[model samples]
Target: MAVRKKKKDRRYSKGCNNQALLPRGSKGWPMIGESFEYFGAGWKGHPEKFLHDRMSKFSSLVFRTSLMLEDVAVLCGPQGNKFLFSNEKKLMQPWLPTTIAKIFPSSQETFNSGNSKFRKLLINVLKTEALQQFVPIIGDVAQQYFESKWKGKKEIMAYELAKTFTFELACKILLNIYDPELIKYLFGPFEAIGKGFLSIPIDFPMTPYRRAINAAKFIRKELVAIAKQRKIDLNEGKATPTQDILSRFIVYRDENGEFPGEDEIADQIQGLLIGGYENMSTTCAALVQFLAELPEIYHGVYNEQTEIAKCKAPGEQLEWSDLSKMNYSWKVAREVIRLTQPSQGYRQVMTDFMYEGYSIPKGWKVYWTALSTHKNPELFPEPEKFDPSRFEGNGPEPYTFVPFGGGAHLCPGKEYARLAILVFIHHLVTKFKWEKINADERIVYNPLPHPAKGLPIRIYPHIS
Candidate 1:
């Protein structure tokens, strides 16, 4: 809402002074930029094509390119991952494009910085030990999902069902809103808001970006109403404060002993909603797709889950210990996601720095992806093969298989994914075998993979 400018550079070397040492690549045409080129490749199912193309042409790990709204240096592989992941608020800081930032409850001062209080609070709740409590709840949700949405339906769209399933899980676990009607009501705006993150920034009639911002407003209206009523419920002892994030927020107080405003509460809820949205759902669909395609891999998961079920009493849900013993199954999951990681990560250089003999100017955006490392034959022998055993003992070398990303800024939902995916896989493999309706279904990237026809599949329930 405020016009802002960067302070004079009294700290770092001025203007690409080490231009000779900068990575080699083109920024494409002015204004219109390489955004189209990047999106074109993604829409064609090659989300990493833009980066891979430049890598082969320049033969360099780091290359200069323009993307979205700025000139960025595309950094590749483990070392690149290390630089971006490890240097949070050190040599670099988190970043989002100005146009896209408008869609978020953003402040130019702290936008994507590691110092966000909201992020800190979120991590505190989502980290290792705290997530163990959600295991059975997630397992129960998975069972219900199959019973209502999957079982008895001879054929269904896997991706579409997966999106709804994950959204419901998020509502139940994160917000404590387990009513199906309520979840579906909130999902419409959530779905629309998600598209804006991957769309052109043009905020006009029917544009994805415009729709996204509009959805955010609609979501806030509903969430604010809920939050306001929740505050009254907490004060009157009609609600337990220990329930979910919305309830938790009602009782939380700042250093000044005051509760956050309604808008602030909505923003935090938005943060929680979007945190694992794309990565988790897309990964869930892909995990099912890959396992369905590879019988042997699916068998491994099936065997592991069967053993775990045997250990439990009849009709008991999956527990944390059961989740722990899902090693081979987890390995299959790791391998599946490893083969298809996020398109890329974003970082903004905080100061001029030198890396591997290249001078990276301060303030330039940095993009990193694991595909450079994930697909390298050296890191993974016969990388094309989906051998879950590759993840058996020690797993792929550090930073080489970063499907959930790495370091301080790593996605806080890694543990959530581990349990949630295993829960879904456990139910999937245990009850029935599946087959793809479209064996050659294509993967189109709308910044994330969407299988052709949303991965329609026929569920052959086990013949008892």
Candidate 2:
């Protein structure tokens, strides 16, 4: 493998005056064997603090660590971020999918194929007409979920419930499958796939990595079957092609008059499944937790829902048009996503790069912690405080509020995720009143960051 050659005589800016230039390492190990020690456990637990400390000490940061794994460089401050994400071809690649592919080998191929097709398919299916059709479906699904799950005096884990909700919603929209048992089986494999993304590359049996590989295989098989059946139905004229995304994808032909193969279709489906659920689940749990902690925000959200309800009759469901009118609910959801970014964005440098007078070698793994950007006191005042109203007037700087990431590789399903969250909040606020069972419950940020103590909130039917 070719290593990134260090550049000579780089110029430094005033902002980076105190930055430290990274040193070179031996052929085998980078950072002279100290790479793992600094970037491993400490970085994981308190990433922001660790990065900040390094920024203050070093004029520029670089790590010559293990060549077996990519070398990681921490780019601190706003100017550093702009330079990194802007160079799309040189520094950007899907690091999360690469991590996942370590366990599920098939995932790498799936991701590569899906990236090519997602832009076309998303533009076609996520428009106003398609979203309008989905409004009723989403409303019905949410209502049914609440009725069955939150009925009676029962304590539930918010994270777990959010996971189930996301799974069901993804199934209804993506594959158009609605069978309960089938949905349960599909969700299990999908969850395993997510776990595999963060697991070590070892494929030993009983390990999370092995299970993730198996789950990927299982999901691909199911997707192939579904695609084949949909194609058959389209050919036989047994089904009318409606506005569903799957149906559109089945018939979509490219410029060369070619449709995607089974593997390609499956890959896109997998990406949608992963993108659809994980972040949304974390955001949903955080929104509920935030509402519980701040009654004023909660009441404001409730009033927004109430106003939305008043727009129609008492029993009427919300429409897409009503979404614009519910600005407060939308702001609350955006703030929650901004604050509780589920995953830190990771990108691998495809070529040797220069930023802020420092050398960032090719094949190095670069990470942007959303917490660092989102919680920056300069961008957001009183960064530790959970105030949704901060976004009420002028929101944070561009690219600063990157909970779903940014740039060309920005999540295509962002609209869908936001819609699902808003719809979920609307239901909870209008249909039920909830209070935290434990005021001091701690939120766990591991395994995709959710309420550690299950966000135990008792729900009662709202009294008009």
Candidate 3:
């Protein structure tokens, strides 16, 4: 039932066949396309509605449209994930809007090998060996975060609190900057950069984009100063080359004696900071929301964490072994991620290719929605339900669940994020029992999901 056609030069030589080869669906109103509706559906809690409705209406595996003023093909289900992920850097590569590029650029272009050396060298520092030692570091950061920020609070905004904690941890783990005043100062401007990642790119004075640019400039200046100091420390034998990413960037040398220049080091670390800060914060907020709403699930997680907490004396550092025993806690975290994915993946077509017996023109954008695969009944029966047990033994089908993305583009900081979140959850569940102040709070998905009003929860500190 599939029709195939040769792709012809189409600015003029158009016909119904040209349309037929491109799949079925309106490109929507020129320029804006169906983006508003796409965002609306997500903001309204049916994030996958756009794809579902189009698949039904067009009766096709793919739907062609213009998103963000670019020709895009939104592919559906796990088959789509397989094709897009498998063909990464071969048939497709990341091609996001300029707004995203302005905030963090190298990530989308790593597929080209044009700028990969810089990124790969930087990621080399965040290897498993380095992260394996960060367990106690994150645990200690969590303990302090809870003591200073959460212990005495009657009510607090979960998103705000999580944002601070995640950002602080990122600074400590990635940059080795733990000064309280510096964290407080950087926190305010970074909010603008975070906002501008999804905002329209109008770089006028006072605009989010402009403010974000300004913030990036300031942060880059600070990073340059930090990197210079690190270089001196490395030369003086005053700092370990592997102490932090800054130090690693200072010391890393390739076989060719090439090293990341100071500017490239700043950009690379900035990308890691942007990535680690946002996803972890949103995910932590989601966990707080879920734990508040589902007491049975909370008790299950609480018991698991409390058993671990009970074994440790007050003020003792958590060992990597502690993280190993919280299997069920990890399950709950995975399910929370599935139920509320942080963002969708977008890739650009590299060469003209055939998929499922249809011609896909080169230079077009293709998107893989995580929600599409996560909610598919074929992969997860009753996908709406939050069943951590589903992940207890074997977990969901491969490529069918990609909360942290998959294939060549899997998030590099994934394990670190996992450990940080688990440690935070361990601290949270063992010490506090919380309930949402606004039980009916709704979620908004600009690029990631967070409560519309920033989830506010009343906390009851444990007295054990």
Candidate 4:
């Protein structure tokens, strides 16, 4: 009699709670939740498998899981992406793992109050018109980089070379830091920060998360010093207000006529540096690998770039107009990004919502992955096959190929990344022919995708 009474009470309790109707699936083990399996698939270099498995077993469009100790809804496919992206600031808001807040303490304040304003400041320099003026500067940097780093080497690690080149470009253009030694010195802690940024937020000694906190502290000190000096220079007219991003930040006054503090400026600068570093570098390394594997594609790019090269006198820098002619090259880059999508968008549910007859309670986390749409057979035929022609027409349907995400919070550096990739492609193929040293090298994601062996390749200068 007591057992029957208890069963009836349980049913009544569940009927009163909206969460009982959450999309189908398990939250996995407690404490860790599904984070192990969630990141495990990424570690195995096929992050799509996690979503693919769940989509097949449960619902294809949405499911429930837990990650980082929070109940999460994994929204799948183009429809899912459109829903989340289109509803930004309405039904959803940006969210980062708790680990980020613990490391960059200033991030929460910025995220809450100054995100839009800060993003506008960043977009000012990355917009197409602004990026147009930097084409020749990038061209010059690429030329000097190749001469110093790749001129005579018979073999080279493509990933390592790409990292250094992108880092130097970011430092010189963004921070106005030109000293090789200073850049090199800063690289170590910055790299530590990258490795620790998305790590599980455990603060124990010697852990990646702990190291990242320490590294961020060190970087904060360095940036604070830099910001303080820049502020002085700006007041004395010793530095131009538009000289670089640091100067611009120093001169910026918000609507309240207040300058952002040193800590906030440091945090934002670090974000930009890392933002421009890892993903662009990954794209560049993978671009090298794909171009080497596909000679037909290489020739297509080489032909286009050569025509542009012929139009210029010896040592002339590439103009913004030249980039427009390399459509096929850009298409190839897009396909590379599709095959190896680097980011996953995370959001927090802002209110109770109903979608596809499922209940999503407020405070639950939401994830929209590019892998689902990028690799879906229905959305992209023969998705594993590398075909640049997919982008030839009007392109993949809206939200299906979001290499840089979508909606109100689109990546601010999108145009800048495009310019950097095209400039690198021009310099790479027009100057040399290369073949992969390891034909079967595998890609692994240690929090981010990279070649298992750094992608070594044999270099042969094109016969002029």
Q: Please, what are the lDDT tens digits per residue for candidate 1 over residues 1-464?
A: 89789776433335656443667778788876788888888788766677778888975478878887587888887788877777778888877777767777543344565536556666767777888777778988899998898888899998988898888888877778888889898898888887787787888989988999888878878888888988888889988876776787767777778877776777677767776566778878888789888888887788888888778787788877777788888888888787766546678888888877677888888887777777776678887778888886787778788877777777777788788888998888888888999998867777776775789998888764
- Each prediction's total of clashing residue pairs, residues at least 3 apart in sequence or on different chains, is 0, 11, 1, 0
In model 3, what are the clashing residue pairs, if there are any? Answer: 93-348
lDDT of 4 by residue, 399-426 (tens): 8998888887788889999999999999
lDDT score of residue 407 within candidate 3: 70
Go through the candidates in order and give the C-alpha RMSD of each one to the true structure.
6.1, 5.8, 4.0, 2.5
**Model 2 lDDT, full chain set:** 0.70
Question: Model 3, range 195-276, lDDT digits (tens) per residue?
Answer: 7767767879988888887788787777777888888888999888777777777777766898767877777677677778
- C-alpha positional error of residue 402 in candidate 2 after TM-score superposition, expressed in Å: 1.5
Highest lDDT, which number?
Answer: 4
TM-score of each: 0.92, 0.86, 0.92, 0.94
> Candidate 4, which segments miss by more than 4 Å at Cα?
1-20, 112-114
How well does candidate 1 match the true structure, expressed as C-alpha RMSD? Answer: 6.1
Instruction: Please list the C-alpha lDDT of all candidates, in the order they appear.
Output: 0.78, 0.70, 0.79, 0.85
What local lDDT score does residue 339 receive in model 2, on the 0 to 100 scale?
Answer: 66
